[model samples]
Target: MAKYNDKELAETSKFLSFVLRHKPEAIGIVLDREGWADIDKLILCAQKAGKRLTRALLDIVVATSDKKRFSYSSDGTCIRAVQGHLTSQVAIGFIEKTPPQFLYHGTASRFLDEIKNKG
Candidate 1:
């Protein structure tokens, strides 16, 4: 595994959140209703968006993220950020938790209210 410094990880995480969770259309990639995006398409779109998101980097990001932000599909052909959806497109299954102390932390500030209301 390649070692990534804190800054590199942060930048990559931010980029993934933007592309996977919030605005995949920003890079012309499509995320399904469950937030799954084709890994190959994600790479191509990210390159078009001027971001170098290699498969190796994606794996590293998914592995190293402290918050466990991203995930892969069962066949490993898809990827998605675990949270922070800007649209209703993603429907990640969420079970009710106790007290609601720990809940979704959205990517944008505008989503905070919606999360609070929905959760």
Candidate 2:
């Protein structure tokens, strides 16, 4: 396994966020319906996009993320974001639940009116 520094890890993590959460197509790869992508293919496609990615770095990133943003498949052959996916592409099986009667939201005062209106 290749050793990587904090900067390398952070940069790779951001790149992962871009491709995995937002635009897999940016690297000429497609995520599955559940948003999982083949880890090997992800590494290759990221290299083609001028980003350096390796299985080792990927492992570190997934292990170190403070927000628990990414997840590996049970078999460890695939990966996906835990949430924050574009619904058009990734149909993660989220459980449906009714909204609570009252909910507290945190936001800047400037956005309160909009939130009230939308809510």
Candidate 3:
């Protein structure tokens, strides 16, 4: 799981919700509800909000977010938000393609291994 101090978590969550609910239109870039936002645009938004758009901050947020909230292509060249609440019981592979790598597994390796064997 992604680790963050209270401040960082709050900031990242706010940023995510802001983008998801309002889209980029509020900041002059027009984005459809389910569209990608470029790094430059994200930086711009952070700057506009008076947040420092440092590489460290960006990396922390991306690394720490739940995989269900976002996705990136195999090469890590493109990213988009996954639709819907993470807790909803839906098909595991609802997104177009399987993720290039697994992000998190809830419990210990022994448990995951048991699950894998059972399935």
Best candidate per TM-score, number? 2
What TM-score does prediction 2 earn?
0.78
Query: Which lDDT values do the candidates have, in the order given?
Result: 0.84, 0.88, 0.56
The segments of candidate 2 whose C-alpha lies over 4 angstroms from its true place after superposition are 97-119
Better of 1 and 2 by lDDT: 2
Query: Which pairs of residues clash in candidate 3, taking residues 3 or more apart in a chain or in different chains?
Result: none
User: Worst lDDT window (10 residues) for model 1?
Assistant: 97-106
Superior candidate under TM-score, 1 versus 3: 1
After best superposition, candidate 2 residue 51: deviation in angstroms? 1.5
Q: Candidates 1 and 2: which is better by TM-score?
A: 2
Q: Tens digits of per-residue lDDT for model 3 on 32-102?
A: 33455565666677678776654455566666776556654466543455665232222234458677675
Give the per-residue lDDT of model 2 (tens digit) for 28-55: 8898889999999999988887888889
Backbone clash pairs in model 1 (N, Cα, C under 3 Å; residues 3+ apart or in different chains), count: 0
Residue-by-residue lDDT tens digits, candidate 1, 1-119: 66767788789899999878777878898778889999999898888878877898889889888999999999999998888898667887888867767755547888878877996
Would you list the clashing residue pairs of candidate 2? none
